[model samples]
Target: MTLRSTGRWFWASDAEGDRGGPSGRRGGALAMMVVFAAVMGCAGAFAAYRALTGDVDAYLASHRQITAQVLSLGDRTSAAARRAGTSAEVAWVDGSGIGHTGMTRLRGDQVEKARVRIWVDADARPAAPPMGGSGVVLGSLITGLVAGAAGWSVALLARSGRRAWTARRAMAGWDREWRAHADADS
Candidate 1:
């Protein structure tokens, strides 16, 4: 096994004079990469936060909760409430005196005819449960993190694209110079 390996991922700079990065200059590229990563990360976090807040607010505002009963025996292994919880059918009455039936995810053991609180929409249909305080916080945090990662990816792509463009331009410049001095050299 020919050992020809260099730590490139952790250290991707200062390999000039023959085998180096694009553009023949890493100073500006490094600065731009840092700036792009930071800016995009911040922007993504902010944007995700704003969107999460708006969606959460709207969902909570449009939904309400009331007492409901388990109508059918939901499968225990249905994966609906497999995490220390059980799934079952439910029944509820909306504000307009209309009755509705739907499946609900209930915590703990919930047999048939068990009563539980469930979220309902305007048409008395089973809706997504209200986002709890902790859920909101956690969701926002995750969203921000994902967005930050996406932003960083975009920044890296942009930097790589710019570097490639610069390298191509440098190559073209060399080609042009060679063609211009062909006759003179001969």
Candidate 2:
């Protein structure tokens, strides 16, 4: 058997069998594009959801005031500050002609204050529970996956193109070699 047939190199003649064949390459490209599109779509949707359901001014006001208070205390680094409870007195009017005094703890610092703000409701219950580290972890994972996939897809396309080009060049060299041999015999 000829080297081409024995080694299954005949497939080289059929462009469809090439790694960068139109259908296969298009499928790979389309899959990569879909993944990119999905990531972008999710990011946009998340932004819109936050805009619609979240109160940006309220969040900013809460953070600014609480952060200032924490910074002013200068007890940010002390572990004791975390355990110690500093109180603020608040006054409110009741049903009768009586006023009331309520004490709220300073908590730790800005980081703690932000955590409380997200987790606790007006009633002081854990209403909007914080996602905590999970959100960060998930975001990192998604970002890494998308970036890796994009890089890999681009590399695959480049490699496939190079392979197809190399195979065509080799076939041309083989044709030239056969022609030279036939001329020598004549």
Candidate 3:
């Protein structure tokens, strides 16, 4: 058997057979296309990450962190609450000196009148904190890597499928040729 390089793959053939055929060439082209697709996918992921980072930065800038006093703990003894955390009624004043009361989650160890740092919007309403720098970078990198791996897996599956189809066709042709030879000899 002889093996010939087709881009990143090796196409094998018998000693009497020529180096692959149309199917081999098509497979080589497909491989190149898959590589290109993976590259494009990674680039697109990075672009999406940059846009998301900007939006998160804007959110962080618009929000503020303030210390709030826990007035009371609600459902602190519940099994679900204990597993998740205790829900507490907290009060804080925004930059405008307007007082606000809201519900927030705190560790079970927290007690009434305990001071905790919380994020709030301009209206002193409870808000979620934006993604930190390290988290954003790590998340983006993982997403990009997953996308690239998925593309590569699909390419491999397609190549294997094509190879199986080609083999079936070749076998059919060989059977037909053998039958014709047998008939001619009779």
Candidate 4:
């Protein structure tokens, strides 16, 4: 949907070389890539916004620190490499004096009755730590950069392919012309 009046073409809808020529195909592909990059960047912006605003972190933090009693130990074999803790079933009393139970990580070799600090959400459900502001910023930055780079790469590849195709077509036309004139000089 780019304006071609100014002679600046991003993507060409016609790559078949029969209509708008190879330039059209390359431009059309590039335009699509730009659209994709924009969409990805917008999505990343929304994610960053969500991470920046609201009480997502504060609410979780206010209710996060707690001591829980280990009810049962979990196996560590399935955990990732260098995972410091093993999963365990735990129960703890919230600030409201209400009892809640969940599965959480505990130091390896921790036996039953051992207590550990755990983080819980507003619904008293075990949850991961909230993303901090810096983390959000970093994530959004990386997302935008990656998206832009992807778009550029796509455009570059399409442009090269289009140029090569055009060159081959030009050479073929020249070969046919030369053949037609070859007998004239004989």
**Model 3 vs. true fold: TM:** 0.61
TM-score of each: 0.62, 0.32, 0.61, 0.47
Between candidates 1 and 3, the one scoring higher on TM-score is: 1
Tens-digit lDDT track of model 3 for 70-113: 99988766789988788789998776788899987787498899
lDDT value for model 4: 0.67
What is the C-alpha lDDT profile of model 4 across 1-186, one tens digit per residue? 222221222123243454454345545655777887777677766766675655565665566677889898876676561276787899999888999999876665778998877778778887665667777777778877776677667667876786676566656666665766776667
Task: Give a tens-digit lDDT track for model 2, residues 1-186.
Answer: 133322223333345544544345646655766666566556654554454335544543333221111212334455665676443333343335454334445554343223222223343322333343455455555665665566566666765786587677777767876777789789
lDDT tens digits, residue span 1-186, model 1? 221223332124344534445544466665666677666666766676677778878987888788998888756775655774665678887767887788666777767777788887766777767666676567666766676677678877876776566556656666666766785578
- Top-lDDT candidate index: 3
lDDT of 2 at 105: 53
| Worst window of 10 by summed lDDT in candidate 4 | 2-11
lDDT of 2: 0.47
Error (Å) of candidate 1 at residue 39 is: 1.8
Score residue 101 of candidate 4 by CA lDDT: 94
Better of 3 and 4 by lDDT: 3
Q: How close is candidate 4 to the true structure, as a TM-score?
A: 0.47
Clashing residue pairs for model 4: 10-27, 11-27, 11-28, 12-24, 12-27, 12-28
Model 4 CA deviation exceeding 4 Å by range: 1-97, 101-118, 183-186
lDDT preference between candidates 1 and 4, better one: 4
Backbone clashes, each candidate: 1, 0, 0, 6
Worst lDDT 10-window in candidate 2: 64-73
What lDDT would each prediction earn against the true structure? 0.67, 0.47, 0.73, 0.67
